[model samples]
Target: MLDACYDTSVVQSAVDLANTLKPVRGEDFLESVGQLHDFLDDHPALGPVKPSEPAEQHAAGARWSLTEEDLAEVRSVRETVRAVLERASTDAAGAVALVNDGLRRSRATPVLRVGDGGWRTEVVSGTDRCSAHLAAAMFGALASVIATLGPNRLGACAGPNCRGTFVDLSRNGSKQYCTRACAHRVSVAAYRSRNNPG
Candidate 1:
């Protein structure tokens, strides 16, 4: 199981944006316009985040709609986020610079609210619509990850056949593969190598 520490919606949204760009078996999910829309449909946060939509407007208007322009904007942001993640894997300073630039562009501010658990902090974003909403949420998460976990935790998989990037939300920093399936495949290969001995 993934560590629950980075299990917030913001983090997951960021992860989804990065994952869509990273290839898996020669297939990239956001490679086309149709696919991009499909990705939005599949992802909860990126689709239609109605943070303050009115109930009556929802009946008469399509407030939760995505335009073609929105898709392009999101794809652009996805690329930027992916670059930052890739940099974080090897160049912490570069990653920080990139994420800082993203935060500035997003114009997201931290707001505190009292909750049942305790006082909680949230990014009160200036962007309150489709692609911009996704971008802002992703950057907010990136900022938190860089500050708390450090940028080194953002990385692409080392598995020979995998191209997915993962946030290291583990209790210990033992995770190198993106998924358990990838880890198992590597383990099986190692076992075979030891037992067979070419």
Candidate 2:
């Protein structure tokens, strides 16, 4: 199971959620989270967990498919989260603002209250009604991941050709690329640059 710690699964989920809104070259929303979990599960060094299928469908002919507008909204949310992750300092206000913006964009009202020793969230009203619950869940999950990624661990990808932000959970704080593949690409580029100067 993916604990609150900043493990491979948590990092993958954060990146996946953001990328689901605006996928990179070869990512599909349907299998993004699952694939991430699969990788984590295979890596015993990093806690293992079974992958859960996305509750929503992305099929060409599904009764409840994501629309262009939905994609846009998701993208906005992803951008907001990315902004927070890339900030030099922890932005509590910005986090709240982002949550509010997401709720507003979803046409949902989040109910805030002090419970269980801290602030808790709930959806008071909305289109889907369940949207509030989902938002609360997402917020909680993100919070857990953020807690694990101390201020120094959050960063933007250092791949020269990539601009995605990511949470670096490596022990040495040396993670630069958003993904291993990107890291490999960066290495190859560096090697070429060293071997054959322009």
lDDT of each: 0.67, 0.48
Model 2 lDDT on a 0 to 1 scale:
0.48
Candidate 1 lDDT, tens digit per residue, 21-139?
64656556776666665665555543234334321312211344556777777778888788887778689888888777777776656555444455555553567655566666677
Candidate 2, pairs of clashing residues:
none
**Ten-residue stretch with the least lDDT total in model 1:** 53-62
lDDT of 2 at 56: 29
